[model samples]
Target chain A: MTQVIISPAKANSMYWLGRYTERVYLELHLLRICFDFMIDGKPEEYNRYLASIGNTFLYPDLAAIRSGLVHDKNNPVSVLACVEMANDNAILLRDEIMSPTLGYIQMSLEYLRHAAAESKEPDLDELQKLTDWMLAFWGSIEERVYDERVKNFLRLGKLIEHLDMNIRFSYKFYRIEEAFTSLLKCYDFEPRAFSGDALEDLKKLITEQEYDPRDPVYVNKVLLLLGKVVIL
Target chain B: MQSLIKNRDSVNRWMERYGVRFGVYKNGVFNEQLFPFDSIPRIIEKEDWKVLEKGLIQRVKALNAFLWDIYHDKHIIADGVVPEEFVYASKGYMPECEKVDPTGKVYSHISGIDLVEGKDGRWFILEDNLRIPSGASYPMIAREITRKVSPITFVENHVADNRDYATILKEMMDDMNGGRGINVILTPGRYNSAFFEHSYLAEKTGAVLAFPGDMTVEDDIVWYTGLFNEKIRVGAIYRRISDEYLDPLAFESSSLLGVPNLFQAYKKGTVAVINGFGNGVADDKGIYYFVPKMIRYYLDEEPILHNAPTYLPYFKEDYDYILENISRLVIKDVSEAGGYGVVFGRDLSLEKLSELKELIIHQPRRWIAQEVIDFKDLEILESNEKVERKADLRAFVVSSGKDVKVWKSGLTRFSRNPDSFVVNSSQGGGFKDTWIMD
Candidate 1:
């Protein structure tokens, strides 16, 4: 295995790549639900969908924000926004990721940017394709990325965002377990929690998923094998 | 067609062989990427290029005169042709170049003038890029690959050769050497925007690519250092950095990118620098409006090409009209280029237009408004479908000895977006290989 040494620039890219790819993966699922609801004659519930992510901040009103989120070229936090961020991070880490992986990301972003500019409601199938590409993209990274420093830094970033986004999206059990297990494995030191209250909630979340087939304990063992704490 | 483009993998190999690429910074981070090459060609006829060649020469000669006048005695300003404030206040105008003329009164030995042909087939001068203009290397390499892809295509067509750009540049450097030593291409580093062009040019011309740290000035002579304090005098430098970042002692004091006292060496006649410092005063967008007048004033010949119909908002009448018709024009900041600081009036809301109008009024000198030319579209393939998009051409004019020679083909860049009129490569555009058929 090639030892991946994370330079400062690559660290920044890893952190943002985590922020951006997670943003895209999570939003595509959210937008999929919204699009499905549009077919069911539940237009009123769209505002509830909007409220789940704080419509007032990202949009002007619910309608302006929702449409903008879907297609606005100016919005820095839309689906296109997430892709742009991913593209930018990928561009920065071209040498680290090697050319082929970077080229794929660049190509994918180019497609998404064009799609966003042309269509107000882009084909959901194309969006699905991008998500699948992103997943395959991860596998490719795992294969090509040989340096441990870069791998750990990228994993640390992935875990941080995984924890943050799963909590925000209200993922009940499995996703949260996956996030914590990743967190424990990637970081040597943990950041301060909110008076240990957040830690207590985390412990409860773990206990709640204790006996599930998709078990938290399985994650615990993976973390330990990766030289992380065997947190109960 | 598929077989022709199957050379994409081969083309990538060719790029590796030729070491062709540029560095771009996204979010303050630098990355080098292979500027993708397409096998398609944009062909022009010889008869059409003869006119373009004449106009480009006339334009570059006048620009050279303008740069000399701006740096020396302000002749254009004193003659009341251009405002003195415009000359003095322009960001590209350098005081350090004052009283120092380049060898044989030449400032722009190599000029890249960008032009575009309308649907009616009349070409309009888009802008005059007198500084270190890039993209010439792209077509240089592309021509080679295009021949490999389909050799019979070149045999059937009488294509004017474009491989002499380096020869012309070399002769120009040698002309002004004044018995000094080796000529070099001074680059900021490996991460500059046109690093590929700089390196390729150095390789092609057999000139060393020397960074600032690799050089030192002693007794008004610029000497490049070899390993461990070995030194050799450098005669001519085709530098790829802007003037402000060329020499810290001459322009910006805090510029770490610049070599200190390099301009002093230039002024001492110990070295030659192509497209000399302060040439930007001529390439300034505001200065673009006066090229035809300069041609008439200096060269006494009718300009062979026409500038795009442009309006200077600093003039009261033009300002009022641009304010009123803000929804139809393209307004650009006079000092910015590379597709930055450009606003399409049609894209602005009424309220936003009013706000922009107020800002323009506040600083009229900084703005120029132009009627958007219905720039002709070129066909490109998108998702297996032919799409028409706006594109522009940049012609290279190399001044060697006593002549301004135009390369037969130029780079034709097209906006990938169907509706976008801007085709700057930095703005996510693609290029086509231009061919001048005999």
Candidate 2:
């Protein structure tokens, strides 16, 4: 019956661990889907897709674009960069996470680092393994994290990132609604002003059949609301 | 042993997974590096550990009694067993902690005593670390990962388990909890060099890993504040911060690391502070010279362990001896730790030796010279080849109430540089898990 108080610093790290892990996972998946464009040698489409996700960098070839997506440490959006940040955060919360769980993060990072060092031709098969490890990472979180409150905070950060990614990628309104529904089902957040009320407003818009999903202002407001957390 | 040698990198990888790292700050930037692990372990026969356990327990007990006397009755100093100047002038001596009764009346609840074995099979006490000593987790977790890397080696060898450190630590903390509340491990933050240890021990002990701001002091009581504003009273604090930064109101005015009025709470007798404040007096290099005298004066017994032949320049005879043997002794600055401020006579040029001799003559109290023991060299692997390295053991002994226990394992640190004798982790040394054979 020893006391277990998570310092604010650790809680904040766990929150970001959730955010960065989800961010990298989503970005990696999106790029895997975009690999078809890379294969077709439509570098322009990849450029357009990168711009759509707020990446303004210009690349002449698919290799440069692929490098920016997967390996570039300087590029903040790369899988390697996001995983490194997530791994850093996870390192601080080693007690909160499982040993095998953290091992996955470290091994995945080392594998990516090694791949980057070799600078070989892009191996999509290996890149897909990164995605698989992300799944295992979340699975480990669900299995190993003991404190429900701690887990809830992590899940909340992840849900917020999920909502943000869906919005930025312009997923269909139904898909956004489904993700929002899941967020409401699993997420937990600290109670604050505008969070509860704004959440309800977004729910109202999402559930309403008459609302137009094309309205930018309405979509922005809904995005803001879906960022709020609540257990279903 | 063969399997362990082959699986060294795998164990190191597991250490990285567990974030076995130490942080260092240089040029105002913080950098963290792993405390490299050597697959080879330092092995001690059970008979040797038996002697070590007895000596360590006896030494810690004498040191604890010394702290109590230094603060309360001053019998040791008044009777002239130790000079009052030596005890009062130490940097770690806190005047605010005078006469404060610690939990179970224990001052040094935990002690990490550095020891080395000589070539002639005799052990020498290098130094005593009474204030917030670390490096225990290195050997503890190293044993855990080592077991993974070479299970067959462990299955075959009769090594005593070191994994029980957490349970023993928790029991000590429980005993230290003289009041009604929860135990907390208060750390400065994640930026500390031993932050990994702070968190790891907290997790294992089920103690709260808390920062300065997570808790508040009110009515001379420490409270752990939750996000929902619920407060839990703290019974005992295994505080890892230095005494100067333990309480802003009581020690340093500008320290943000300290909790405001925490010393007030401790003074009010609501919380137990481990290794009690002002204990630096007992571990001071100057005071170290008097430990044998203390063992006799307090315990009325002969010391079971031996200190390396040491000469205090503060005494005229010892000073004369140090001057005569300026080319054959190792001189240490009383103020420095972590392998800093150590000078070997042979390493110094004649000019430097003369300069050091002059400084010692002027400020005799600041220097202590010792005839370096020809310590045994342990074999360590470097680049897949076995090489002999100078290494020393740091043994952690925990005491609470009447119970005292020496942990079965120790951290054996070896100097990575071929020419260096200092084996501090801060000095780029590496460590191996110490196995006290069952």
Candidate 3:
């Protein structure tokens, strides 16, 4: 088989497509959990979710919070916005990724727009479909994309985003460790893209015995280290 | 066929799921809209296709010969078969490519010849698009989805398979490459009007889809730039960009969408540019008037295809005739394309007709008047109702180093409006697959 060569722009687009799709998927999952908590009489759950994602703006009510997080076009962290960004990047990689693979992103964008237009409050079922489409999108990517290097770049973006989101949500140490391990496997495909010193520092921080999820300074340090791992 | 028509909705939905769309700019904002597919196919009988196939191959071969002569020996001009003024004064005539020769002397490797069938069972050539002709992918993908939606329709009808277009394209590119390096389809980015076709064709042909800055030239050789500064030599490029925006250092200095010195690589014979440079001169509307003469001069044979009755105002007799019969003719400005700069004399008021007459008299070489043939209309599905609409067929011809071959199927575009004859995608028209009977 002939070697598949990817240009810089295509590689960048593929990486970002992976990252943004993961962002949309994980954000909706977290939002659904927080929404359940709010429904169970914990009104402060929305504020806690916002703080976890590092978003500063607060919604006026539960309805406002759901709309802002799911359908707000102006909100950079909104599910709709992330879907659009993933689509924008996927559009540029259609030749490499194939149309059927790109179709999932297009479907998700169309579904989000249609659902938002139909209701003021975010429909949980429709949001569930968006998450399903993201899963299908990744599935299509795995089945359709042929180049191993292209898959590696996209997988790297996905693993890194998963690690970042798990760290932000203060997940269990095992989950963070699993995400980082998955990322390290993909990072081995293109180690030149990662900073060696930062990789070493992140390895040390994650392997530490007292790696507490509730410690703010330690979490900040891990996040900082994670940010420095990828050198664009 | 009935089953296909009944499942038009499913076919269109499949088209949407695959993101089959074309980009258009309205009021300075770019929007990507789905190229609506009508399930009702335009069926061509095998006997009719046989004649069309012969005519198209003959025409493309003659056109290639004309380009070679015009750029090198100028024998057609020397013999006065084609007017010197029409050849030299054409906007597509480039002095920079006067002596440059492309691989295998194949200038128009791919030709999209637009034709409209008349009510009298005659096909009249409307235009020849030798430079970056689109709409092939629309029909190619439409057939894919339509067959999926209604396999029984394909089974019942003995229609020729239209799926070999990508293979034909690949073979042509390989013929031009001559085992140099990898093949790439260079696109002007995703915002271009035909970006979907660009990407789709790249995927189908197994060619790399390259954007503007994805390539660079060094020492008269073109190379694709990888993320880590790795360079892979490009053997052939099926460039979708216009000649003006192909190379910044050679043609348009201000073009950011062109690779600098890429033209130098082409001129040095280090790279093969499909549908080679300086091909616009042959496809100009004014130059279209002499294509029949070109067939005779170059091929030593009578044209199997017929040109629409066209009169160039550059000649005294034709000029007087156009002025005398202004209301019955359609005047076209040779410089504009995509259904623009076309004026029906019947639609213009008396004042506008007078102004057009003056413009034609002052700049006779810039215009051509054709007797509008009442082309046969094809039936299209509109809101669950079958309606008659004006449609034209765009047959694609591929010229490799070996021979010229015409694809069995064509892109049949129809005007959605009842009163309109323009069938371009940019003008909000829809498309139907052309099924050539086996």
Candidate 4:
């Protein structure tokens, strides 16, 4: 066997792949609603819905979200950009994921590249095919690779991205719980002590009964929930 | 079939999918690019391989003996086969490793020797890369993909299967470990030149790919630092970094890339460092002059392979010869590898030749001048056109449990430019899948 150089760059790569792929998945889920509103309901109503989510600056108009996700590589939140990020991270972490999975990523990138080059509004079927391939790529990864620490780190990246995008509120709470719980069970983290009052506030968010999703306290509640679950 | 042969785009795509790449740094920025593969392959006959295998094993064994002698008794130096100045002055000579025996052996556990066949059809030694030689995993994997893509081509030919490289590696790691815990592969990072290869072999051999930060030294043993729980003991580390960069405490005090106290840990017999320190002593370009002598002294047998006719500029007579025939020689700096610091006398103008002669005279010990051999070229398909380029084979020899096994296939790198004889892949070169008939 040949001598291999396992560097920090590769680890960051694995960590980033976990984050960007999940970002793509989360955005695709959001696009379903964005697309539905554009076709069936009014674009004005969808814009209002996006504004309520916060970071409306990312996709301010429903029509913009519908047309811009696949077209713009400049948009940090765009699907095209997310896939590009995934490809970059995948190459960096290529040693951990093995070659077969990497082969799938290369194929998926080519598919997206061709789709973006030819289509204005990419056919939903073609978009779904690329999405499905990306998901399948992740699925095969779970089956074949078995380093729990590496897996949990990847999940930590995904969860953090979800929290950043303000999409964690819509995510199944149990999924976040499972990810946090697994991080706790698998690795013994040595974190620096928190000196601030966020701890008490986080405690109140979890213990208090009025932490409801229907109120204007949506962001506060989600933050408290995410914080309580993660700060082991 | 014709379409397959002419498909440059498909081959490039396949290279990306298979991850055949080497990293290069341009203007202080690192970039990874595909190591272009030519559809054409270099074939070796069964009879020829038999001779080549014997020669490689013989060469590697003598190198191993030389490394042992360097660290232990200095008998070779005492016997005056290799000059004391050559042993002590060479940058590869490590004084810190004196009297420290690793697993009761001192030579390299892994060696990648570069060789080329001259126009006369005789194999000549190009260089010996005993320090962390790469590109074995490349041929091991590329051959598999190549065979899969062109099954009929494989069926028609008698190419030796290159899949056992990982198994051979496993055996080597295990032999060094003495049945210890898991074998871990230490990589510099994915940005390193052979990062793709590092990852592929780690996966294939079931060795955990670990970075410097991933490891910790405790109780004199090396363990993988876990994020959550128990740290697993790493018995053997097939490190890819050079010895000077492996342990900051032992070598370069300012190097952040190395694991701290790694040398002390290895000295304690807690971990094994494959391709041991001081292996580089035998690979120095000046050391090439004495390898034939070392073989004769150590093994009492004649060398099977021949070194290119070389002149040691350190010798007055040889310096005179080089100065007289300066335009016909290939000059190399003893300290540099990877196609760097090599200058062809024929390519230089008269003024440049005069300047080189002065430099050689000023620092004679720093250089070696060899008679240029016109090696055979291989046909490579680049942009739908066939071109011939100078190529050389880097053969990997792995030693485990008192046995040395030579992998059948080698990395056959070729220069992309027609007039260029240099074939280091980092210098805008490409590689061909080498086929060794058994």
Positional deviation of residue B436's Cα in model 1 after best superposition, in angstroms: 0.8
Enumerate the candidates' DockQ scores in order.
Answer: 0.02, 0.41, 0.63, 0.31
Encode model 3's per-residue lDDT on B1-438: one tens digit a residue. 889988988998888888899999999999999998899999999999999999999999999999999999999999999999998999999888888989888999999999999999899999999988988999999999988999999999999999999999999999999989899999998899999999899989989999999999999989999877888999999999999999999999999998899888988889999879999999999999999999999999999999999999998999999999999999999999999999999999999999999999899999999998999999999999999999999999999989899999999999999999999999999999999999
Q: Could you give the CAPRI-style class of model 4?
A: acceptable
lDDT of 3 at B125: 96
**CA lDDT of each prediction against the hidden true structure:** 0.72, 0.83, 0.90, 0.76
lDDT of 2 by residue, B1-438 (tens): 889989999998888877788999888899888898889999999999999999999899999999999889999999999988888887767788788888788988889999999999899999999999999999988998989889999989999999999999888888888656888888898789999898888777878877778788999888888654568888889999989888888888899998889888887778888868888889988889999999999999999998888999988899999999989899999998888989999989999999999999898989999998898999999999999999999999999986989999988999999888999998899999999999
The parts of candidate 3 lying over 4 Å away from their true place are: A1-3, A54-59, A208-210
Candidate 2's DockQ is: 0.41
Docking level of model 3: medium
Clashes of each: 6, 0, 0, 7
lDDT of 4: 0.76
Model 4 residue pairs with clashes: A5-B187, A5-B188, A6-B187, A6-B188, A7-B189, A187-B228, A188-B228
TM-scores for all predictions: 0.65, 0.94, 0.97, 0.87
Q: What are the runs in model 1 whose C-alpha is more than 4 Å off?
A: A1-232, B1-9, B16-19
Docking class of 2: acceptable
lDDT of 3 by residue, A60-118 (tens): 87788788888876788888889899989999887788888888998888777776777
Residue-by-residue lDDT tens digits, candidate 1, B183-302: 777878667877667766765676766666767788898887753245788888888888888888877788887778889988887788876877888888888888898898889999
Stretches of candidate 2 off by over 4 Å are: A1-8, A58-60, A113-122, A186-194, A205-232
B156 Cα displacement, candidate 4 (Å): 1.6
Q: A76-121, model 1: which lDDT tens digit per residue?
A: 6577777778876765454456545555565556666666666555
- When candidate 4 is compared with the true two-chain complex, its DockQ is 0.31
What is the descending TM-score order?
3, 2, 4, 1
